[model samples]
Target: MTENLDPREGSLTTRPTAADRARALLDPARCRGLVPHDAGYLQTAGIEIPATRGFGQQLMRTRFYAGVYQLGRPIGLRVASALQAPGRDEDRARTARSLRLRPGHTVLDIACGPGNFTGTYGHAVGRDGLAIGLDASHPMLRRAVADNPGPAVAYLSGDAENLPFRDGVADAVSCLAALYLINEPFRAIEEMARVLVPGGRIVLLTSLAPGGRRDRPHVMVMERLSTMRMFGRDEITDFLRALGFDEIEQVTAGLAQTVTATKR
Candidate 1:
């Protein structure tokens, strides 16, 4: 069941400094109990959960609207992590295993909800590497920002379809469990393609119907209820290829699929 946590301060985007981020992560009241107070969820210093449009949303507008209207202290994100612990963890592990991340690489995590993979990226990139997380939800970003370890981590409030960074700036880009929420998935892929330097990598992990499309009954039911749009593996790969991504491969997990692509 979803729990409601209220925010004690202004929106997360308001005055996002290291001090604010630190407080939000360490001080439970600052983020309104958004981080779960558990060993598995809370022990990880670099993990943060971004605010999502609840579970199984269908419409992008509704998801965005839900993000905008949901008031009060945001629920601790670690709660979801504790409940759905490793929901899509296998896919993430698989993607992480395949990627060739090195020290000092500049990594960008689009839609880095709750800092799950963000934590993984932090581990992979090491202290020298820089990880930038981008998400549209303030609560989510706030929680993620709060959770991430300092120095190598930074969270930005922006849409995946419209990233606010210089072109060819990232050495690698990864999006975990967030692309399906985008209204224009193709456009977002284009943006991802545009942001990476030559030979930069992209990893996309998303949940959808069992097939390679977005029309599974169970998933459809969830989407209708949640008002969110989910995409399929084939569609995601094709979109990436069309956007000039090469060496695209799809890997399946418990309920979601992960796609890895390298920029040509």
Candidate 2:
């Protein structure tokens, strides 16, 4: 049986309490259509039952991020856009310049939320190049397609850990903000490496909570709700190196880190 809770019903004030939001995060029915669900064995007859792992366990293996995107899509989109708005253009330009994307290079953007990086990449690659945006959420992909329309841009539904493309099809690849949310982040990185042509660049932007510091309340809440652990600089670098990537360069920007590496 699925439990449905509306985000608007409980609190007296317009805003929901932290507890309310947290409770909503635990609802299994919220993720029913978006991901698969598995029912575990019953502990005792009419006494206790084991909770199904569902898609949350299958992908992120966390209660916080199990149905996060599907549940928070509207607010999440706004938050993502607003946060990136301040440095959106400049960041995109810097990444494009750093990667040296030309008119004919194909770029793959993993977890390309709401077409932020996808639109910029599409523009950077120009008419001759292709910018493919892959994301697991259908609503996000719909918004991405609606917001970024061009012959050079395409959107697909896929998980980062298991990318849908063939080997060595892209000249460059990028994943932003959503890496830590993945359960097998290294597998996702391997997929990124797999999809890139030899010598192709891979750019990543993700949180850096060194020593697992939870200084910011919002960041802390997100991490708690999503059950995601941030990766340190060395951990990411080691993964890239082990995957045969070279010339790794990492730079910190506020709480986030940007890494650029070349597949060797």
Candidate 3:
């Protein structure tokens, strides 16, 4: 229900012009599709940050890590280079199958980081299918585009809380390892529900409490960080149900659980 407004307009005086709306629509910030526009916008608004409290250093490292992970070839190479840690590969495969992605399905990958699951999703949908990966991080999206350049795949810089897409525009919506970052997770879920066509599916991959951890420090740390504003399995299921999703179910694969819901 968020309305488009121009930056120059007084509190509620003037409405956004078509040109302004188009520009805003094209803005990368709009692409994130998240709520609390301030958070996602500020995070990517090119504000210079000096190294302090480890935040700047962390950002650097994250950019680097994201860059490396975004490299689809390297990602595949790494996966191929060594056997996936116990249940890791199996988990991904299981999640993809659970989504039932097939030819002709149009997918919207919210918070798709470096096309990790995006690649698997591409295969699931086949050539006729379309996969749009939306993310707030431009650097990350750039890497994704560079690594996995091809037809039927597009990278969008947008938030999840307020998706830019029209109503009921996608057959499936998927967010992997990134949904927990949004301060308003439920709002994003509602938007996901809005964008999906009737009977369309949505998959949210996260480290739900019911899914026991594997004693990996990095994994634990990541989960802890995400938990800052994230919800547990029950909370997610309830939220999705409240958002009008039907047949909501929690499916576990290794340390991660995929919350599956269908548009009512």
Q: Tens digit of lDDT per residue, candidate 3, span 1-264?
A: 225454666454443322232233333533432232321221323222222132322442366767665433334433422433235456556657767788867787887777666666767776567777777665666666666544456565556776776777788888876555564667888888888899899998654443343355654565466343324547788888878888898865433456888888
Question: How many residue pairs clash (N, CA or C atoms closer than 3 angstroms) in each of the candidate models, in the order given?
Answer: 26, 2, 13
Per-model RMSD to reference: 12.9, 16.1, 11.3
- The regions of model 3 sitting more than 4 angstroms off are 1-61, 70-89, 209-227, 252-255
Best by lDDT: 2
Model 1 regions more than 4 Å off? 1-94, 215-222
Output the better candidate (2/3) by lDDT: 2
Instruction: Give the deviation of candidate 3 from the true structure as CA RMSD.
Output: 11.3
TM-scores vs. true structure, each candidate: 0.63, 0.64, 0.64
Ranking by TM-score: 2, 3, 1
lDDT (C-alpha) at residue 22 in model 2: 19
Across 19-45, the per-residue lDDT of candidate 2 in tens digits comes to: 232122222421121221122100111
Per-candidate Cα lDDT values, in order, are: 0.60, 0.63, 0.60
Ranking of all candidate structures by their lDDT, best first: 2, 3, 1
Residue 135 shift from truth in candidate 1, angstroms = 1.2
